[model samples]
Target: MGTVEETLKCPVCQDFFTDPVSLSCGHDFCLTCIQAVWETEGSDEVPFFCPECQIFLPSDVTLEINTNLQTKAHALLHQQRSALREHTVVEVTGDPLSLKCQEHRDELKLFCMEEMVPVCCLCVLVGMHKNHKVFQLHEACVDFKTSAADFKERISDKYSRIRVVLDGDERLMMQIIDAEEMYMTEWLEAQRGHMEAQIKEIDSLRASRKSLLQEEIELRFLQQIKAQNLWNPLDLTPIQEVDKDLCDLEKLTTVERLVDDLSVALSQHFPRMWSHLSSPALDSKSAHPKLEISQDRKQVYWRTQPVSEALSPQPYDSQYSVLAQESFTTGRHYWEVIVQEKPYWLVGVTTGPVDKRDALSQSSSSLGVHNTSWCIYHGYGQYLACHDTQEKQLSVGKRVRKLGILANLQKGELSFYNADTMTLLHSFCVQCTEPIYPMLNPCIDASGLNTQPLTMFWIKDHWDWHINTEGAKE
Candidate 1:
């Protein structure tokens, strides 16, 4: 390949970049391949520098892709791939071995992890699985079986814990209900016995009165009536009345309330689980001297005059920006910002605080201007996704009043969205071992036309952005 052709190749991978980015020194490279080289080295004591140039560079140097060069490189790569495709003879089962390739029919003892298929040695060398991760078929089976066993055991343990709680609660509730029922039954039994005794006494009184009426002499009947208390108008008295309520209704209400509280508690569990996914409040310590951080530290705006207060010897943010204090190392996270009519703005995520000695020049301090962060920049009408010193111009259909950023470190993906409609604006694949934090820069006011403050959006109740527009209406 000529020098021009070699220019399209990354120094680390020596291949055309699927996604290209340039360092501050104007050296182009594949973003993924370079990240692999940098991330694997894993030594902070050693200075971060370009592989090809061997020049010392800022540990957090910005990286942004040159689209024109990226296009040319990809075009060249496609041509090469097409040429390779034409020369390779794709014949299957050439040796008629026991484990032959399905397509080419060569010996298929290796398993392609990426494609989840068995392939011959030829496929592993130069076919579709050439660049993919592969292993012996037996090794893949053993690994997957071990993983399945571990997952099953974990799931069963979780279920067991949940079942124990549920069973304990069920037993307690049943005991209470049974106790209430038994108490009511005993009371009813006592009332029934008393009513039966009263009925027996009434029957005996009537029988005696009949005997007195049958007396042959009127004098005898008068004597019997005078001796008996029942003779006095049958001693008129009412029978006992039944109770209005059979059981305590209040106890039932208490049980219902307990259930309602459980429902509410269960509903809130998920929000607490993923609460870190929301935006962390901004760090005032990282804010520039010319910016004012809100009392809540969720907002930042430029002041007409730089603040007279000093934030100690630590370097102030050089890009009129504020970064998040929290350093997230694992899990999927999401955050949003309210830009609302701002003519110039930058928003994204960055690394943990670096010492003053590692701080970059003011120009290079801008988020996305270095490899340590990824961000979107908007000035005038243009939108760009920036990393290192290179940028890719973005096409936005409408003005973005708010922005959404999603960081899935496990997947090495950072995606930007238009928060209003949640439409994708841009995305980046990042693989860095350093912890990351959110960042924002409401660029200096442009001739008094752009003064709106940038705000960290407080996501409510599981990403349901029911943003109240009352503030906007005002």
Candidate 2:
């Protein structure tokens, strides 16, 4: 080959970019290629500018010639392109064979922890594998096989359990979504009603105000016309010199001001109408339900189940205290048992306390107390009833006494019966998640005489009331 001048030149140097320096930008060219620009007047740094873009480089510049790039450049410069390429390939393949220690050379073996490949013993104490978690080549494979089985079984079981939970969550998620959509519809309806009511009020006010103003304007104009007509040239005595000019100006100014005020009021108050119409307000909870995996990867529960009238009642409810005790105390409170059920369920006074009036001691006005605790049913509502005991003589109005609140309808309904006469009380519909409070007949005075106080609840087909000390165990 002819003497290769190009071979002596750096490819990055091309003409003068030899002894090339590489910038952070990955552009490689001779030092001279970028040095001048970096040293330009007003330039704060030298040998620190990107050659291609003239973008300034940081002060902590590193311009080392990349060995791989230099090699490639040199190969390009040489006339033997194919041979150079082949030489590069051989360089990549030819890692020098590591020598084995004399002691292990004859039967040398090694284990690669990373690759899990067995190597000659010499490779073990050499590059890369020296600090690796390795065992003797023969022992490593056996250990791996043992551990792999255990891990496989464990992982499989975990994933299987996860799949089961995932299936449950998927089903529950659909219900949750449906519940949320229903809740949103209800909430939106409520909000729309409220807003429309306000809108109607505002429109009424506007109409009334406009009508009054228009009447005033018309009256003023009429007065002005009357004044102008009085000055008809043919009229006799100038009619007290009707000043139409003054009348016209006064009416015009009043009408203009009134219109302006109404316009401003409308703009200020009704500005949000379009926005509300376009993007309605979301319920307290977003309609969207999010599904996420638990940190421990356990069962899934809803973050929010959405609020619907059918599912949840307002929080600070006082109706739950229908048959609250006069004085709450242990063993002294009254128990209202619904004897109609097989379980003979009852929840009554557990604490000794009473809401009081003056001049009355616990004997006169004892109130019933409850544990305030309840049983929660998954996918259903909880059931509870206040204990009405002799400790407190709670009274109900005639109407309330005739009607008893029903609750936990999903499990069963609550109906009250006169413990004495066993009379049937009226049954009431129980909304979801709401506890029923049965308004009671007047407290039986200490004499055990039943008074005709307003009592709620009528007789169901067959129900009885009984007090068993054994069942009263707290």
Candidate 3:
């Protein structure tokens, strides 16, 4: 019942619809007017809502022509055109559809690339976009369209190559899994065959031992019978008259020997459960200048000289620190240091590229105050583990003479042990990124009374013995 003009008006522009389209919410709108509203209101990938019902419209929503609405709009427009033709008396004015700046009321002829907006001649001269990079509106539109095309082509090419790349990766993974499976199967089969052979050999040896025992039992029984029959009842003498050969001890000795051999074989076949000792020598370059090193480079101690001669002009920095020549980056390694009766000592590992300057005042520059190093310090009857400027007190019993360090770089574990008792004192779980070297600090006592040297215990490869012929001359 409403007027055709009123019914055909667009909600956005408040004018007759140019090309009408219907939304999913059963609302009609001018296609160009709805598009402009959406472009201004939402991002390209975001959904827009209907003005009346607030119904959701997808970013890729298709605009279908509303035939009925279009026909009504066209009829109303025709009537307006006829009325305009009949009047045709006043002077013509500028196009109402031309875009104009809101403030200046002048035509928007240029686009400011820097500000990403349109500007009129007046805006360029005095507005906020003055001196900004700009181009003609048509030229800006053409450039944007070309860039959009290039972006779309690149996205299409990437999408086309995705399937091939994924297929190759999946194939490689499957091949790796298959290879691992084959290797494990072969290894398991070989181990099974070896175990079966050992079991068979054990069974054969057990049967042979059982037969020997049976023979011995029978022989002993026969000897007992013979001795009972030959017993002297009148004299009540023992069965000494029986042959001494009958009482054979060789069989018992053979069984004992067999048991001992089996024990030795079993021990040789199994891997050792304890950590193996390794020899680590001190790196002379890492030693403090005042510390003295033995000829073997396995021991270090503070120099026993006058204070003025031994001490450096500059105060002690990391002058007490020393590192081992051996560096561990992977796998497990263990070494022990003899710190018997030492009043002050520190042992741990440090990564290379460490700061060796005199910065004792700063905890960050000192050992065990950063991620690069970790150590256990012993002083004044207290034990502490230090790392990243944090110290943790350890509850270790009586002081131990020998200290052991076990490092498993792959597992990111460093363990300190009491070598005398083979007991773990403390352990640290760390995040190691580089090769680590054993570090030691042979600290001098405050009263300068303790001078015990820190020695690395090395297992000798050969032993030498000398005879004292001087006693014979005497």
User: For residues 1-474, could you state the per-residue lDDT of candidate 2 as single tens digits?
Assistant: 323445344343455225567777766666665565566644563436564677777887866755555555455544345554533222311112322333344333556777565556555566445666667755886888889998999999998997897577567655665666677667667766766776676677567546544655777766755654633543222113334553344443554575577558755754221121111111111111221222422211122323345522322122111232222111111123222211111222112222322212333123223232121100112233333321222232221111112232454433343343434442222232323222211211111111112211223342211223235433
Tell me each candidate's TM-score. 0.38, 0.15, 0.38
User: For residues 172-268, could you state the per-residue lDDT of candidate 3 as single tens digits?
Assistant: 6566656666776676677667667766766775675465447557777667546546344323222223345544445545555755785577558
Between candidates 2 and 3, the one scoring higher on TM-score is 3
Rank candidates, TM-score, best first.
3, 1, 2
Q: Cα RMSD (Å) per model?
A: 21.9, 36.7, 32.0
Q: What lDDT does model 3 reach?
A: 0.71
Using alpha carbons, what is the TM-score of model 1?
A: 0.38
For each candidate, what is the lDDT? 0.74, 0.38, 0.71
Residue 265 accuracy (lDDT) in model 1: 82
**Shift in Å, residue 316, candidate 1:** 17
